[model samples]
Target: MNALVQKSTASLDALKRIHPLMPWFASFVLLLPLPLLALNDYQIYLLNVICIMIILATGLNIVKGFCGQVTVGHVALYAIGAYTSGVLSVKFGVPFWFCLPAAIAVTMLAGALVGIPSFRLEGAYLALATLGFAQSVEIYIRVTNYLGSASGLGGIAPPSIGNFVFYDYFRYYYLVMPFMLIAVYASFAILRSATGRAFMAVREDALSAAATGVNVRRYKLIAFMLSAVYAGLAGSLFAHMVPGYVHPNNFTVIEMVTLLLMVVLGGIGNIWGGIIGAILVTIIADLTRDFYFYQLLMFGLVIVGTVLFMPKGIGGIIDRYFVSKRFVAAREKTAEQKRAEAAAAKSGES
Candidate 1:
């Protein structure tokens, strides 16, 4: 087992060294044919949903996992992005391309607002503040006539290039996938930078982070803003997808809870965990569509079970497993080397 793992690791390392971006390029190539393989439009639509959820989960992971901020209002920011883009495209005749950036800017401002409370609050209190913010946004949208209230906004335009419109699931998948890839890649990049280190420092210990001049408040705000960018991009993509529309109910606490479930199940601080969790949850949700009553119950049970048995989440488990394998392999290699050295010494003496 040790030898196998060591060989596998060596192969992976060699591949990575040959071309650092090869894995990413290969993944993109693999995904390109997925729509063709799908049984129907519905499967393609589900794939699109998975891509959107990946963005959302990745963003939530930034705030909750990386920064250790207990926020429950991320869905509201998502809603803000969707509605902003939808309203612009529907009412103002703004193009989808313009709305995308505009929505991101607006959501980033909202994220900054959400982070304001984080400077003074922590844990449940910060969560409550964010929750209140989310509820307020929903309620405001529900009563605002201009924002479409209950009727919701429709007729949002899909993105186009030189007369070619991404109006179908197949076309939109291409549009969304690039953005999702960029978002995930950017996240990895950020987490490796100084800002990312500061965010983790705050997550691990705010007081200690402050003692080390980490600027905890600034990093927290940055985390929220970064996450908001992701949520905003996701919202714009979703709004511009087939059946372009934006509704208040879609951004409610229920949606927030679902997002939280994704982050938690993925492993709070693990990027890969968030991605895996989103994909898994979306697939499971699709499978259990008819069992709506038991869906939430099952999700709740999963969360509890994960917290109790696998606090690090699925990502953590995978990480630990690989680490253990490497450790065992190293031990075996060292023991063999020692045996070889001892035999050589004995032969020399003889």
Candidate 2:
């Protein structure tokens, strides 16, 4: 038993040695200006959509991926952030920068409020409750004339700070990229902290976690709130990127489903998976958008296929094939050595 423990400890130490390099690798890749240098207008537009979707996936992963809670109404909070920023900046004469944080705070509160009820329910019941809440929020937005009702809000201008103007995709790219980086970093930090462990414990077995003095409800609410804040921040980015107007339809059911699919397909609990899954799904969806009628069908097929073949998501498949194989090989070698030692002992006894 002691030998087994020491072997496990040695393996974990090796894993830890690579941990410090992840952030460095992530930063290096993010610094690439390929989008600014090579992409044309159409391609830049596609990249913008994919970047925003990646942000959305990271946010949703906080709730669904890390906390093991399923939330289908994420787009509603996203819409809230977009409209809140849009209305405040466009109609109320607030700066885009100022409205951004306000929207996040309000949406975070709203998420906590919703969690109070939904978190009390488990499994399908929780999902249904969230779905209902999202619909209600959407209906409220549709009926409110302050949001321009059915016609939607428009004429949002590009943001500027001290003579620097954001007038095109290149400028917007820098703007959105920072927010994406911050969100990803924040999610990574959360997953590494005690709160993250609490969430994992709650996810693995709420009753077991509760037995160990983990405040299951509080942590769950925290996860929900954090997730909402992320969605709200994403919404703020979307509003600013478009730099004009938001409509009720802007936050659609399809967007929510897409975010969930990205989270699930990327590998729940795996941060990189969420980022990659978002990009992959967005790229594929955009590729098919030219088809108009067939786009939805294509998206459905991709989701179904991924689930069937890679049910653990793409990240799971990679871990299983690459990481697991190494561990298996190491174990086999250890077993063979033990058998050789037993044979040597028998020969010595003879």
Candidate 1 RMSD to the real structure: 1.7
In candidate 2, stretches whose alpha carbon ends up further than 4 angstroms from where it belongs are 1-22, 25-30, 332-350
Instruction: Name the top TM-score candidate.
Output: 1
User: Candidate 2, residue 56: CA error in Å?
Assistant: 1.1
Residue range 149-212, candidate 1, lDDT tens digits: 9888888888998899999999999999888888898899889999999999999999999999
Q: For model 2, what is the error of residue 239's alpha carbon versus the real structure, in angstroms, after optimal superposition?
A: 0.3
Which one wins on lDDT? 1
The TM-score of candidate 1 is 0.96
Per-residue CA lDDT of model 2 for 1-350, tens digit only, reads: 64675686576666558895555455647555858664588777677777788778888888887788877888888888888878888888887778889989988988898788755788788888889888988888889888888788886666778788777777777777777777888888899999999999998999999999999999999998999898888888788775466888877677766777788789887888888899888887777777968766766776788778877787887667657667887999999999999999999999
Residue 93 C-alpha lDDT in model 2: 83
